[model samples]
Target: MSSIAIKFGIGKSTVSDIVKSKAKLEEFQTEIDDGDCTKKPRVVRKSDFPELDRAVYLWFVHQRCKGTPISGPLLSAKALQLYPRLYPDNPADFKAGTGWLRRFKDRHGVRCLSLQGESLSAAMMDVEPFREKFLKLVEEQGLTRHQMFNCDESGLYWKLMPNKTLVTSREKEAKAFKKPKDRVTIMACANASGSIKLPLLFIHKALNPRCFKHIDKNDLPVHYYAQKSSWMDSYIFKEWFLNRFVPLCRNALREKGLPERALLVLDNSPAHPDIVSNIYRWIDNMSLLATQHYIRYPTHGSGCS
Candidate 1:
């Protein structure tokens, strides 16, 4: 191999690979004595099937741009679909399996990490200031794991199906196939330790639907909040924070032997009001009612959490 590398002026590893295969012309010139000569050529992917691979890459890029969730199986199925369309006469014997998908990702430097939907308009400089403020609040308040909580709102279309499905033979599409928009906005709150999962406040469209005639509201799994529009308004938001959220957080903290105080982190939105109508902010003494009245929200002047 060293001799071959010296003679051909190629790298030793490359020469070594060829030495086991390529022979001195004298040995080849004599006869086809003992060497296997009918092996398939090594596949150099860059030069191999440029059209097919590029289509797959382009599809992935397009999906990412549109914020579509692309899984491994989804890409594999897409590759299979693209093959026949890309190459009509010459159908390549390519298996877009797990091995192929992994190699493709490595080759293209495609990253598969957990994705968070942050505002696209938000700048990099805006993040550090927010982080500093949040940390300062934590330090000043002396908040613990049980006391610190984050609440996020999301819409879930419970009875919806993904747009595409694999079909084996000649199969028919479902009757009146359409993407579902049936949704309910849910407010979920949990602490850093994840020891407690609070009762999810599901805001549904129907105020008094016919379906719940037999079902008891108290016995329901989720804390169902009713609204005609199924949205979080100032009134609904205040009610949730004051009535449901405070008591739950207090109970959770008490169970864990922590402080009654909790830092509820919420995004700055129109639904969150600056002032309560007739009551004083902060230490609102609710002696008439048994419940604690210290459910604090950020004011408009104080701004974002």
Candidate 2:
């Protein structure tokens, strides 16, 4: 062993360790493909529950192929669920906790990443032409940073529960409860310069929820409204535009000693009405005191930066 270590330009202890692990190295060589024998890893750790590990890894791969997201807790839960079925007669005490999950991921060479959706899709789309056109329009209209604004709405699950939880050793399974579906819609508007932010328009299913029964709706921080679906609609948006938006914008401009003339950027949502395509006609009928121009921005693109 000493002669072999000297020939390989290594320490004698290293050769001794390799000699001790000869059986394991042979086992690894047999497990991998013939072509991959030359690409063997330096270290190979065996799983405590081999069948369970394999089953979990196969299940994870199947889910990922179907575009299903797998969280750490979800993976752990699935492992715990499958263990009993895999070993009905065995008395193995398996708790697929965080430590076990870490090792499992290392064994399978798995990585956790954020799911890509609309934002990533939008990034891939060509928005440069739209940006150039928008810049040109801004320059032609003599619009300042403070005079350009953008508005958008989003849904909120107010009473959503956490995806994970903790349980005692005495309790083998975590308690399950009906997930809440309580929701609301919120709309926000702000200028490019960040000089002004209008009051949020909050929409709920109830005109006066039980929590706000004793309080006046007008006194609330948000400009509250009620709709059956708790979603933004044409009527609600029109009301917000004519009543809330115009007056607030006029006041804001007055305070800044600027003309009550500005441009509003919006998306092509059904709720925004037909003003985007024919804003001049709509503005004429509304007979507003201030001049307001509306621009229909691409929905896939983000808000004005």
Among the numbered candidates, top lDDT falls to: 2
Clash pairs detected, candidate 2: none
lDDT of 2 by residue, 1-305 (tens): 88999899999999998899899777767746533223536477778898999899889889877656678888999999999998877647899988898878766666666554454334333466657766776786676877777888988998998867987789877877898989999999999999999989999999878998779988989999999999999999988887888778778877987766667777667887764433432342332222222333333422110
Stretch of 10 with least lDDT, candidate 2: 284-293
Model 2 CA lDDT for position 81: 93
Relative to the true structure, candidate 2 reaches a TM of 0.59
Tens digits of lDDT, candidate 1, 1-305: 67778988899998666555555433433322432221223322341456877798888889778756677888888888988887787677777888888766654656565555554334456567767766776686677777767776777898798755787676776444677788889989887778877888889998767999988876787778877778877877778778877777777777878756666666556565654322223522211111112233332121110
lDDT of each: 0.65, 0.75
Structural similarity to truth (TM-score) of each candidate: 0.55, 0.59
RMSD of model 1, in Å? 13.7
Quote model 1's TM-score. 0.55
Each prediction's total of clashing residue pairs, residues at least 3 apart in sequence or on different chains, is: 0, 0
